[model samples]
Target: MAFAENIKKIFTLPDLRNRILITIGILILIRVFAHIPLPGVDLENLKEFFAKNQIFGLLNMFSGGAMQNFSIIMMGVGPYITASIVMTLLPHVIPQLDALSKEGEAGQRKINQYTRFLTVPLAAFQALAMIKLLSAGGISGQQIITGDFTGGNLIIALITITAGTMLLMWLGEIISENGIGNGVSLIITLGIVAGIPSQVRNTLAVITGEGGVDTGQLLSFVFFA
Candidate 1:
């Protein structure tokens, strides 16, 4: 079969094989990071809250469940993506950036550097928002962060989350340089894919009435639909 031959040929080519392997290795590393939770999180309460809140459930799916886990990479490539989007739009509005954009690769590199710089504050801000939301504890009145989530712990969390975003950004660049395809997009795609199984299971539970679809909740769902 042509498909089979092509698959075989991919492995037979050393460069292609190495690139594929490198991509896989990086993806595995990202998944591992997704499971490594940050300190001070009450994961049980967090998980329960996510289970009850559809909005955060969707966010968790996009985050590869890192948000639910309160992982270091909980922000994933989100801040970087926001930064890239901002940078892309800025060149259109700012004359200086517009002129720089015409410098070709050099200009693009500068824009990318700016994007990376922007990601830091965005990551920290998002981390703060997440902490605030989780600490609020939803309808269950159960805080996702146990005890006082302030002072040194809060500072450490912000730095750790921001650093995690930077680490992912660096890894994505590495993949782009050494592996195949657009690394950041690949990471985001893989994250979405990784959450599919749990999403399906949750959907099934809802359909089977195991999700306890109350009258108000059902009405809200229908209204949204």
Candidate 2:
């Protein structure tokens, strides 16, 4: 088929092949990072909380189970995304940003630099909020953190998560420079796709009356689907 020939041609070109390989390698690395849990958290309680809370469950799904695992990259480039959105909108409200936006590539780079800087504090804030929320105990009344939530543990977790976000941001930029598509979009897409299998299994369990999934909840899920 013509489509098959085009696909074959893509691999035949050394430059394109290398780019594709690099993208795949980085994606694998990201997924591996997602499995490495952050220290001091009660993973079982965390998983139960996410399972019971629809909102957080959805967020976990979007993060490809990273949130449920409480991984170092649990935030999953979310702060970077927020920072980028803020930067994009600020140009409309702030005269300085508006001027920079009109100056083309160099100006765009400056805005991007600013976005990266903003991501740091945003990530830290979000990390702290999540820590507090989990420690405070959700509807389940079970603390997700096993021990004390303050002091050294809090600081270490905050720094690790913030660093993880920055690392992901850097990886995305690398993909943009060397790979085939928008790096951040690809990372998000990959996360969503990676979550599909578990989602499918859960749906099947609900439909089969397994896992003690309530019939009414299944109906609601079906309606949402």
Candidate 3:
């Protein structure tokens, strides 16, 4: 079969089709949500924020463009990972948790619940830190929300961001249950896959442009071909 026929055969398998579609949707959501900035991040202030921060480079890789957008999801999964780390240390500090882990499936379930419960504050604090850091870097309070980082807006904003992360986390779970493959892993994979077509197109564009591939590259392409 030709390449298209192979693709058609893959999608014709119902499970594979659903998995592909689910993957596509999650990727779309990731792309779209990351662009939705929190009320407070000043797009104008980014140049200054990036000026002195090593974190921006790291955040860019993890958050894609979310941090640059100052999105509610700008914290990405950093807090979740942190919470997991803390949970790992819990057994060493707390005897009760250490005992609980001995309880098997039930214990593991409780641990997961604890991790999730901890994730809220973890996410909130992470969000706050990111906001303050970026703001101090040069973003105006006004840009964070147009006006007033009042007590209410701060809580609301925190809740909004926390909830957004939780929702993404939940969608990942649903995808795992209803869709094929591991949901969380697929969501992460989606980011890399999402960038592929465009990169390929860009490469092709360059290849077809004036001078295009040099003799060596063309020869290499043919050799590999």
Top lDDT hit: 2
What's the C-alpha lDDT at position 155 in model 3? 81
Q: In candidate 1, how many Å is residue 71 off? A: 0.7
Q: What is the C-alpha lDDT profile of model 3 across 18-92, one tens digit per residue?
A: 877986687677778878976654565563343223334334434655666666666666666678789989998
Model 2 regions more than 4 Å off = 1-3, 203-225
Better candidate number, 1 or 3, judged by TM-score: 1
Model 2 lowest lDDT segment of ten? 215-224
**Model 2 Cα shift for residue 12 (angstroms):** 1.0
Ranking by lDDT, best first?
2, 1, 3
For candidate 3, the per-residue lDDT at 153 reads 79
lDDT winner between candidates 2 and 3? 2
